[model samples]
Target: MPEAYATSAVASGATGFAPTGGVQPILSVKHIEKIYGTKDSVTHALAGVSFDVAPGEFVGIMGPSGSGKTTLLNCVATIDTVTSGHILIGGRDITNLRTRELARFRRDELGFIFQDSNLLDTLNGFENISLALSIKGAPANQIAAKVHAIAETLGVSDVLKKYPYQMSGGQKQRIAAARAMAAEPKLVLADEPTGALDSRSATVMLEAMEMMNVQFGATIMMVTHDSYAASFAKRILFIKDGTVFNEIRKGDTSRKDFFSRIMEVVSFLGGDASDAR
Candidate 1:
């Protein structure tokens, strides 16, 4: 097993964060490995994967289906363990936390968005958002204020009374995002957040996510296979065979140009066989 990345803890405002100075990463993965099966037959789910996401930065992870993108996300999110190496969040080693400690850490420090809306059908949009607070044992009066504030920021306040089934896919997703942010987590992890939306809806959701990252100083790491979606990120990491193969920053390029660059990289990874067809 490889050694974990060492970090320095520091306090910031009321957050008790130990941000890496300058380009210090809020989330760091160092030479991590995940292998399944016995010594005789092993499946390497991850190999030497390492990266860092700084506070308030937006990063995207891109790869083919089996390239370990989701695996890497899971490992960093502390939902899965690595066979070797380490994952640090806010300068704390989560890989060593016990199961219950990990649960509390995740609930308090991470927000998640998935391809599915994942909102409860029985709950109104506002109730759905408030439910997270309720589970966290927040006061009743505070839940209302918090839900309204976050919904307004997410542009979904008007539909708070509506059910998920009554809302458009975009609206449902917006609600999901609002719910995620209401908890005020240190890091937001999204897996193909726009995968189920139409192009227009996807655009709206992506814009909302970008807004959160910029306005709230929310750090985000999104895993996706779409160039269009990844282009919305300030930085992109391309993974291949469980390792980072390339990285690109937006720089001064337009979104379309950045998308093109992403596609070129994807094509290269595909051995010249890419494009949607």
Candidate 2:
């Protein structure tokens, strides 16, 4: 495991977020590996990747293209299998789960936010947010309550009655965020959540995600290439050549300062210049 880079023990302004004190990690990726191809040709997408995300902590994974950040996320999300090692979510070994069990585990324990909002074209914001609970056979009132609470927290309540076409990019994304958290999954995985939005919209979406972390107590592991987007995370794990090269925690630093630090690391890692502000 690479040594964590930041000095502070905990994230700055983590008052509302749940503490890791004496608690088991919400997600654990232990020396996991992913490789593809035959004897003559091999691709090491991920090599000995190991990390832990405590309850309510928000972590970012950043690396250059082909650095295996996406591969790592897929392995943790169980969309792709690891070549070796273990992944435990909420104390359950998902890598060893049967096909049926893995399906149930995904629906029950994981929430995903993608680059695109991925909202159903036919469903309005409220219906979209309620879909997960509806599939779980939750009662009408219970589903409504969960949707309302999450939408309100994400500041997307006003758009509940609107369809994706009727909302702004930021609004659509916020509603999508509400849907993911409505199920109150043990962990949320986000991939470039702000990638598709304009600067203003992206800022709004990031703020909503922050609320989801601090207010909703959701543990998130997001994969992003943009330093500005990554600044929102409490800590960052920088991947290089399929391994964790370094780590940084927010500590007492402000988001602006954290962003600068992230940019510095990006420079050191030979990341694309556009990734910086």
Candidate 3:
């Protein structure tokens, strides 16, 4: 690990979007290594993966299946233990935290969105979102305000009262995004969030996500196999064989051009570029 990347304790009273003046990365993966199996047979799930996600940046991780992208995400999300390395979120070294502390840290610092909306069928969109804060014991009076605020930002305010089954896939995804952002987590981790949506719905969901990043200064790290979805990010890291093979920055580029660039890289990486559309 680089000396500059050493883990430090998070500052006290840090909220999810807590301002840091750009001094420290919101999420840091330093020389991470994850291997599966014993000495006799070892599977190198990750090989010296290192990266940083700065505040307010939307980072996309792209790789084909079995490329270890999901493994890396799991490691950062603390759902899987790293064989060797450090994962720092908000300056705290989560890799070393005890079980209870890990649970508490994940609940308080991390927000997650998956391919499935994961909204409770029995609950309305607002209730489904508020349930997260409620579980964290947020003040009852404040939960509604937070839910409404996030729902509005994610363009799901009108659908807040609707049940998941009653809403379209795009609406459900936007609601899920609202739930992820409402708590103001230090980082949002999304795994193929638009995988299940139709092309039109996926476009709407990506636009809403871009709004969340631009409007709320939300820091997001999403893992996707779709080129179109990845183009929405400001920067992208391409992983292959458990290591970063390449990276590209949107850097004032139009989404169409960026999509073209991403497709070129995907083709270079031997991945199917047909997914771009």
Candidate 4:
């Protein structure tokens, strides 16, 4: 890859870390817990949550409603502070980082894709991505070229100049995916990226994320209620009522087989069978 491209990837405010020898984890969370209020009236959003993601791993977090998947994502994303426990990115302890440092850590180390596109309504697709680079202080001359390159990789170059509203639901989500991967974050956190799309669109988005993981060595942690979407991940960690219920790995399993396995695990977790379809 060209230095110009690499610099842009680094600037994208998300990370797909470059090859580090079988070295260290890109992100780690341990014994994390979050309580919404004081002890008596507390709502435990996360209870002793723990996980580690290696470089280039694709992971999914699945659960029924109110399962704390989103809460877990928020804590690791550095958007919410944990009441207890620790989080580290690139082996740097982030749980204790000051506000400004945590902001920088989030910008330099993590990437996010929420259920909503979260693109600026007025900006074109390219601008939405470029804005992330801009916040990271990337030079202006390199922004357009890098955004174009990432958009091409995500198959959204045709809509580069179109505003978010001008695109279809699938198109918007693709653009959002491009933005998430644009910064080449060491880890990408996606919360229900396919939740709002039709099946065809969701498949397209999942395939794009899988390509990023396989080709760019992008590490990903996604939260979803969809078994089909979870099938794209190498492993799935199931959560229930603010605690981890179980986990399953895909290994050499085919997507169909993986989907069935995921459904079985979901059933074991007492998730509704109807939702699997």
Candidate 5:
């Protein structure tokens, strides 16, 4: 709708575009392709998918089952490899990195939150969050303040002393989010972050994610099937048949308006209500 990189590069039918708006994109997916199997069993999990996420932006990826949303996430997360094209994070071409370099790159530049909390039962909230900062080689003395600061922002400060089992579902997820952002990684990959929560808990989790993006300047890329969850993002990229189908922004619009547009796109994509919710 606007500039190709800042506003609607997807509308221009472009790929691998670097933003010209002073600030460079934090994550660039350059016509990445992921093909599974071979010969007669070939499955193109991703076909020339490309997008740029600017710094401090919250982006959502939505697609129906078998539409390659998860596959795209995995490829960006470096949990899976792409068959073609390149991926760059903070301008580093991760696709060309060696195995050891890839490990270090993932550790230093990436953060992840899954559908489940995935926190260790043995670790308290403070410890869990601290572990991430520690892995990034944060000074031991600064770790506590970082953990507390992020926890406070995400509304998980009250549970920092408690174990995962001792907190509510929403609290645990918030803590997981805090852990992901504790290192202040260049990009955070969230996969179905609110999937395990009930309606109320999901609302709280989404609010926490919003706070993480707005208050702490975290760059987040979330993959969610729920339109309600997708609405929380600053922009939504709809994928169909392994390609970006459409893109919309929440620019100068209320969340309700954004959600309405997302629903319309979902309907047009023939998304299953049971799965998208």
Candidate 6:
């Protein structure tokens, strides 16, 4: 595995974060195929899907229902096995990992944010974020510092003492974001992270995610159907019927322009225009 994919400290006081120039890809999916059911009734959820996510890049996967976006993410996350082909993360072929190694590999290399914040109601925001480090057996004395750094970066420092019930949806999601990044996993995978929030809350969550990618150099691959949420990503891959239909890069374009471009591709892929918002 390449050392570039190893977790590193966010350069303190850096304002604008850019992609890690010329680093090896943190994630590579090579000619992957996923199938379901028997010979008489087979479902091809993914077919020959391939892509590479460079170190520190924020990439989004978007597709309509049954378009195989979730299936692709599941395969990459190692939650579902690929019928064929390979998935390499940080130069390790995850598809070939043994069952026991799978659990350890996921814990040390992957971070996740789901549609729901998924915080334990019994734990306060601080403890909830700290749980990630604890599970990784980080030093007890250093856990607080790690948690505080991520919490501050995600703008949840003031609400760290509040429980999930006490905080608003946006605050809870920010706490979840803090937890995901606190572990400094090689890759962060998010599935519809803003799905449960209202427009205002979604904006706040997306902004925090952008900061995680840019300011902290977190390598993130997000699966979202909403073009608005996908706009925050530096690049997006549009999947349709289990194949890569289109891909776009933000480049030097403004986010608004990028969003418009995303919506155009979404519309081309048969997604409802209203869903783009």
TM-score on alpha carbons, each prediction: 0.88, 0.91, 0.90, 0.88, 0.92, 0.90
RMSD of 6: 8.8
lDDT of 2 at 206: 88
Top candidate on TM-score is 5
Each prediction's whole-model lDDT (CA): 0.82, 0.85, 0.85, 0.81, 0.86, 0.86
Q: Whole-model lDDT for model 6 versus the true structure?
A: 0.86
Clashes of each: 1, 0, 0, 7, 0, 0
Q: What's the TM for model 4? A: 0.88
The TM-score measured for candidate 5 stands at: 0.92
lDDT of each residue in 103-149, candidate 5, tens digit only: 99988888888999999999999999999888889999999888888
Runs of candidate 4 with Cα error greater than 4 angstroms are 1-23, 272-277
- List model 4 lDDT by residue over 1-277, tens digit each: 3222234422232223322356577877777889898758989888777767788889998888887888888888888889999988888888889998888887877888888988899999988999888888888898888899888888899998899989988889889888888777778999989889888888889889998899889999998888888999998877777766666678897888888888877766666433443
Q: What lDDT score is found at residue 176 in candidate 1? A: 92
Stretch of 10 with least lDDT, candidate 3: 9-18
Which segments of model 2 are wrong by more than 4 Å? 1-22, 273-277
Q: Quote the lDDT for 16 in model 1.
A: 21
Q: What would you estimate as the lDDT of candidate 4? A: 0.81
Q: Where is model 5 more than 4 Å wrong at Cα? A: 1-22, 273-277
lDDT by residue for model 1 (59-85), tens = 998888898899989998887899999
